[model samples]
Target: MSGEAAPALGVLRRREFRLLFSAQAVSVLGDRMVAVALAFAVLEIGGSVADVGLVLAAGTFPLVATVLVGGVVADRVSRRAVMVAADLVRVASQGAMAALLIAGVAEVWMLALLAAVAGAATGFFGPASTGLLPEVVLAEQLQPANALRASAVSAGEILGPILAGVLVAAAGAGWAIAVDAVTFAVSAACLLALRVTPRAREQQSAFAVDLRAGWDAFRSRRWVWTFVAYFSLVNLLWGAWGTLGPIVAEQDLGGAAAWGAILTAMGVGALAGSLLAARVRPSRPLLLAAFTDSLFALPLAFLAATSSVPLIACGAFLAGAGMALTISIWESTLQRHIPGESLSRVSSYDWFGSLAFYPLGLAIWGPIAAAIGVGTSLWLSFGMAAAMTLALLSVPDIRRLPVAPPVAGEATP
Candidate 1:
């Protein structure tokens, strides 16, 4: 391969991996598109500000509740089948939403209900996705596969909102959402085309038994659980940025446009980092990942210190890169270290832990800023997030996990 060629090119050249990768890229675009459009859709329907929060929460809570179950299901059956089913369910939910909105018959309640259903399906699709790559690619390909996927996600974050904004302006939120629904259908079609390495099943165990096993698997891995613990705290603490950043931007920076620029910088950084992750082979994977994750503290710190849009945007960019790099390495780590048979189940716990505090973080931070000044609150949140990452780095195992083995022996990707 040429030095300039993406390491992912080799992985993407394979038929099955290409299908899976295409499916991910398309679906992520849809996911990002709907994220922007959904709020506007609710507003277009004459929803109250409270109704907007309600509708979003309605979607988010179900995904959190059911992701574990989805993980268990993915483990028991084909990961491909699990993803296809989840995509179909999302297709139905998003498609219904688009239809109702386009028909001008959509209600706040209807959007919330459908969002909940789609969220539940998303809970399933996510873990299955992390589990599926090992089924399609070689062991050495896991890093590139995951990095390429992250790149797709980063690109979607940048473009999806732009597309949604344009569509909402030119046509309506309904049209943008309809495009999202189409992406899901496209994902389902691609998933249906995949030929994966199949696993032999033993007699199925009870659901509770399977869930317990997954929990055990997660809790047993110190590196996994420890970092998840770190994320659980930091993700919540970082919520302050999400809650306070906008308020600060409006007060100090130029407002929405400035905030949007900051976000766009972050997305660009993520794209850059993911591309780097594809090519850079770290000696201590977990350690590098963990250190990179500390950059997450930047936006909060910069926002706390100054109102300068350029400085804050710079921080946001690095933070976005840090986030993309962390996740790419983390996903690769999970796929390489964890046993394949129960990978989805274990991944569910990871997802569950990481997200568990997010809503609470978002909810509490605004109130906190109301009590203290936004700067004080932001600084505190930054301190906490930085401390968590530092404490996580102190752990020995984070530095222990090595690069991929030169050859696959017992471990087949």
Candidate 2:
């Protein structure tokens, strides 16, 4: 909450953090390309908008189903080992998809199946990666480290779509996906080169018992649930944007290119926001974060209420900014507040709760849109997201989340 700028660049200069950053950056590029290729591949194979929905939902479901287990694994096993395994699994799965497409034998089911597998790996990877950050960087640098990651992700999102558009148009989606698979391999290599020591596992238990212990951590925290409940509602609304927004773009807004622009603008905004977050920490971290989430729905309101490119772009930018701010605060709070041993498990619970309804939102939004209208669906999403933000901000615990004092030992966790 201090006005002084945090030394974000100084943290990046640390050798171990640099390695982690490099690996994450490489992996993010591949991740973004997968999104681009998946959407295009569905369209190329004569799949409907509904098929796209199914593919995306399939990809996201693993996070909801496996996150808790992933957390337990992160807490019990070496975080580096878990990350290495995840990267390898992604490489194999993505490579198979590329080969299938190259053979001209690709099917929607294959795409969906591969996506699900990759998602499961990511479910584990996300928690481990998040939990591992404090181990690699100074406690005071947590916000900046997270900001750098957000910027990297935004950079990938911005470039991947444009690259995929061009690559799929010229070389085919299969080749584009192959490029993504290669990036994963490179990411693994970067991670393997890290020099940091893994945290010693002081206490161990059966996996089932550890799972229950993680649950206990969640049950003990009021702020944790307040954040999770609000995000659950926010993510449900996002599911509508994810499932229907692209279809609306193709049919009503403009086309794939238009959607790409909208998304790219948001990515750029996210990068800007991340950079801003590195220097500015909010006093009311949760309140600011939840309130900013409402901006995500602004574009929906604009698109639903009227058709204007500039307005939509504006809304998307604001939403992206909000997302960027929220990520930094949320990650820092979780790292600082939760017991390091139980951090990943608590994170898994947060992930599961926040995203549990996303697929449901995606699945139901299509039918709801068909029944009433896409515009009406947009209106409904706007209202829902706004309501969730308000409800989250109204919680006394959310408004009172404690910022942990700086650790007195070495900056490393």
Candidate 3:
């Protein structure tokens, strides 16, 4: 052979990746359940749109604040341990919420507190879990591994809302939340059983030093920063739309059941998109993916302009398809381009930069919606998101960047 043969696709055929994927599927299913339960619970408590937005914003605040730090921790400690601990933390917080509701002592404040706790857990878990993928799967099979994970995530999204509806209708939102708590326990068990040994680093650095290292890693790349800047606007609009969409459905279009249908359509479309991404390779993944951001704005416009559930559902499906394509391409890009040791660190910057404005978007969306009226505020969000997506196309580096072909026997950069 002229050089070492590229790692086989058989790397994804390993037992470890399957176990990790299964664990993540279970965890994501639980997350979806909590998502539905939390929204419904707030509505059940007679909370207004503003209140729901505030609560949701509070829940995601930690992502903006601590996700980068979480990446540092993931780089320092055992990634698996970080994931397991985060799941256990979620179990405790969710269990408390479940108990409060079951005892008829539940308050909006309780849900808010638990949501904040869960959010904090996600800050740690997200970076660690993302950083661990390359540790378990060979670089050659990263695409396939990501596809499997996306399929599982889509399936969970499809199932979770249906299950939440059934549980909420039959037993109440609290019971649905309890089911989520149990899934966290299952996830913890799965993660606990995994065995992964980190490679020895040439030099061990302090936490602050490691954080700077991560920052330097990010600042070093123009392509990386360009995408980060673009996604900031993307997340801002996305968070606003997500915060307001269900409320629009429930208050104006139909009720929770209709909202579930819309959500399911989005999930099904995303599933199809993930399957498609598994087969087709793109050259400039981030640049190509950023174009999909505009598709999401149309759905926001539909919800803003009309009360027709079917039209809203169609728009949601289109938006979801775009979102899935963007996610798959972007994740694979990260895996292929970034160094494994620093992937989490870079990903943290990606996550934090993209999402820093999300809480503000969510927090202000409700009041803004109220002031401008839901319909008008939604249109404004749509316009803003569309403009941002088009603006990203003008970034020369983003448009010109090409895929790094796999080099046999060479370490990833």
Candidate 4:
């Protein structure tokens, strides 16, 4: 390797990257814990499977609706400021939910409202986080930087759910959610410590004009939109899995702890995948990413077919690994190809498209499972994931897009 090419840990040595990484790591752990705690919380309040779906949908709908505006705002302001503000918003929302749950006054509508607030924060955070990475690391270090971020997220997933499951068992979901609220506070503190370069000011323009420009940039890239379209369907399947998987675990597999184990296994696999992605550079990045993404179908199929935790864990592991690898490549590609000024906006479009049907899936999965059986619903979700991936591969751009050549000072892969 050329001396200029970053060693695996090289990016972490940078002060700004370290701060950013630490902030994200803590926040991700909290988010994972919340994922488990919230599901069980809804159920604990005499909620049915459909209730879980509705609560999740209520949260996600706002994210889907306002993400483009969030993107525009992120691009306009300091990314770090945007992230810090977003973190604080989540803290308030999660903290309120925790208070309500602990006091035994958390109605379904109350939970949904708090979740919507948190989701609105996420709409801003997601785009800013996507745009922030390139600013903190060198071009040559993008892969490792992305990998490290993914690794932090994976680590959080691995530990957070297990702890959350235990906490929920021991102290109730309220306490677990309370812990999530605190972590967001810590994340905001870390974000406040970072000193990133200021983004170039854009020419003042109408909001509609800026939105149109972002949309134009997104549509101009065939590969970007193609994969985004594919992911919309894939995310729909994921939404179903997210909504129903816990219920299945509770009913058949072994309850919250069993579901936690499955997620932990997935996180372990994702960690390994991120480590591998750091060192490997594929010639056909999108092609490989598309193939890796198809692995997500495995867990859904396994969940539908069997109630064995060990077997389901195996499938979840592969799915998580696939998702991590795909995310690393996809993020690096966007950073390399898209201009920084418009990166967040374009990323917002990508998020908007990819997540457009996610809330619908979350809303519908319970009813679908009820009507056609949980197993049938899962099987259909898996089938759709597989089909969408195959269809994505059929596109010339996705099949043929090559990884960008290394920068002049960097070693060729």
**Per-model tally of clashing residue pairs:** 0, 0, 0, 0
What residue runs in model 1 are displaced by over 4 Å at the alpha carbon?
1-6, 40-53, 99-110, 169-172, 241-260, 303-309, 369-376, 404-413
- TM-score, candidate 4, is 0.96
Model 2 ranges off by over 4 Å = 1-6, 405-413
Error in Å for residue 216 of model 2: 1.3
Best by lDDT: 4
lDDT tens digits by residue: candidate 1, 273-329:
898888877888889999999998998999999878889879988998999999999
User: What's the distance in Å from true for residue 202, model 1?
Assistant: 1.9
Whole-model Cα lDDT per candidate? 0.83, 0.80, 0.79, 0.90
Candidate 1 residue pairs that clash: none
lDDT of 4 by residue, 184-254 (tens): 99999999999998877968888888889899889988889988988888888898789999999899987
The root-mean-square deviation over C-alpha atoms between each candidate and the true structure, in angstroms, is 3.5, 3.4, 3.8, 3.0
Quickly count the clashes in candidate 4: 0
On a 0 to 1 TM-score scale, where does candidate 2 land against the true structure? 0.93
Better-scoring candidate (TM-score), 2 or 4: 4
Which model scores highest in TM-score? 4
By TM-score: ranked, best first:
4, 2, 3, 1
Candidate 4: global Cα-lDDT? 0.90
Position 276, candidate 1: lDDT: 83
- The lDDT-based order of candidates, best leading, equals 4, 1, 2, 3
Model 3 local distance difference test score: 0.79
**Residue 270 in model 3: shift from native, Å?**
0.7
